[model samples]
Target: MRKRNTLRQGFACPERSTMTVHDAVHARRTIRKFTREAVPEALVKAWIDGARLSPCSANQQPLKYKLLMGDAAAPLLPFLRWAVMIAPQLEPKPEELPPAFVVIAVDTAIRAAGAEIDVGIAAQTIALLAEEQGVASALLSLRSREVPVRDALHLPEQMMPALAIALGHSAMEAEAVPYEDTHKYRLDEDGKLLVPKRSLSEVLL
Candidate 1:
């Protein structure tokens, strides 16, 4: 299972197959600033449906998604910003802030490894679907180990929380661009995507 959740994983959209899931992957980014135009609840619902179709281990189907939209989402911003402060630079600019979020949590005790995997896969699904719907998203990792999100959301005790994906109507005049200089990108001598790779190849294999 992939340790980190990403907007990639080549999950194909077999039904339409029009945009090529790869386009979504390469185009997807953690959109922060968002337009003031609120996202319609209908669009959010579609994203959830898209996530529900994600493949699960043994089809355990252990994942669950609860959406917080409209007025129901206001209280979350304060604590959400607190968790986000750990990476202050990553904060969404005013233009990038999403109005609401589709909080993805899972009951891992039932499915174990599959629960984690399902949560991640579902996240990407929503991300892609958000782009398809002309909305934008940002994958906000839940922090503060002491605070249980399930309790905050009034979810069941068994449901272990995983991710909080903020979604909103967006106006992205700026394109997702690679760094102008490789120095900022942290690449390898071979121009591979490298991030502090080990001197001894890290794996000791």
Candidate 2:
């Protein structure tokens, strides 16, 4: 019998050094401020590949993605509201705007009812994948500005813009803080984002 490569064989095992899904979930955070560095097309495609695999209701998948870069993404900034908790202070400055965006849309003609949940699943999947790729992201619901955004993207009658994900290298730090009295997330004096997270004990009940 021929000897096999132990390292290659063990790579698929969960005990390996590679980051696990759980690890990526914990490490993923909503980053508002991003560096000017652009996210490459290859990585964006890979992220979308992962998002496309997200579980959907009754397998009636109906999500669409529009990739925008640099100037293409700049127009979206005025429509997206970010870091509302800290408002202007934590908002992305002109120099710190994300270099790319992924506009998630729903094909209403397919299955319009449950598309919102699908959007969440796809957005979270992309965010997790982006985290693994050393990229940061912010998820925006573009609800109030949907009309204008839809016009700007020139979306077809059947396609409705649902979510917008800002992508780039992180320019600030965000950490999950223990949930105290308030559930609102805030920025510290050092401008670090403090996310409020409830303990497992409180949530398992």
Candidate 3:
């Protein structure tokens, strides 16, 4: 069935492989640079379908998603402006400022119900699937009072808004700066791409 919230008409996957899924998990990073070319709506739907299968608490399916595309910037863009300005300047580009916007509330259907885990799982599922298909996204969190995107989208009142992931086909490639293993992380060796952590010998008792 076609997803209710997206205009994506059809998925365009030529090579089907779970390795792609794994690669997406390891390779996916927050992408801020996007090409003006709009990703096919159907492809986006296919990713959403993949997300729908994420496991929820008791499979209660507490997630509700809404996608924002094009100039539909009124909902969450202005709030993101503060971050955008401070954000590392994007690499120079020539195309239309790619389809850019927010992933309005990604919330669980119940309040204070610990559904965040389920919601996060679904969001990551969508993101990883996007990466496998050559699309990229940035997961962002912000505080704003300028507008009510929730009501604008007519999302349920019970759904709690989570992270707002800005998505599109990135014009630039992103890298996963390596992070130190939690057990190996330490302050003395901290640097870009080199996360701090404890050695396995030190971690294992």
Candidate 4:
């Protein structure tokens, strides 16, 4: 495979390699803190490509992507709400913000009301592909207030932003631990984020 190009200055190319789907699934985590290094544009495009190939409900394929990098990405940070369970603390500091973002939009003209399933699948596909490429990603959704993403990006009337994926090199590590009383994830003594997962025995019917 041909190597992807990175921005000449601050961007660093993610390490490319073949990773099993299982490995990518387990290795992927919701990264909130990120280094200053920018994610390569080519890698972002590849991730969107991965989402493009994801399954769609009734094959409507209404999903659209808006790629943002560097200064273009700054406008989006204010609209994203991070881990509510561990907010304020888990929120990325100004210096630790993701250098790239992919806004997942839905073309209402294609399949307006029933594209939630397709959105979920595409988001997960993007996340998994980013993990396989040695990049960190956080899938974020807007909170109570409406985000003016459409206006910011000049999206068509039919296209509406559904989710945003923050991307960059990770500044922190997170891991899944055994589920206890609550499903909420927490920070360990060492500051690592500990996400809880129910055992297979518990999840399997």
Report backbone clashes per prediction: 8, 0, 13, 0
lDDT of 2 by residue, 146-170 (tens): 5678778877877888899998989
**What would the per-residue lDDT of candidate 3 be over residues 1-205, giving only the tens digit for each residue?**
1122233235445355444566677777666567776766566666667778878787667666666666664555544432343243442243524474435354434435666677677778878777765667766655642135565545676555665666677665444433454523212322222223344575688
The TM-score that candidate 4 achieves is 0.89
**Candidate 4 regions off by >4 Å?**
1-18, 144-147
What C-alpha RMSD separates each model from the true structure? 9.0, 6.6, 7.0, 3.6
C-alpha displacement of 5 in model 2, angstroms? 24
Candidate 1's C-alpha runs over 4 A off are 1-18, 78-90, 93-96, 112-114, 145-147, 171-205
Candidate with maximal TM-score: 4
lDDT of 1 by residue, 79-144 (tens): 464223324544556555677788776666666554667778899899988776556687777663
> Whose lDDT is higher: candidate 1's or candidate 3's?
1
Task: Tell me each candidate's TM-score.
Answer: 0.68, 0.88, 0.67, 0.89
Worst 10 residues of 2 by lDDT: 1-10
Candidate 3 accuracy as lDDT: 0.56
Clashes of 3: 13
Clashing pairs in 2: none
Q: Best lDDT goes to which candidate?
A: 4
lDDT of 4 by residue, 34-151 (tens): 9988677877887798899999988889999999987887767677889888898899988988888999889988986878889899999989878777778999986521237777
Better of 1 and 2 by lDDT: 2
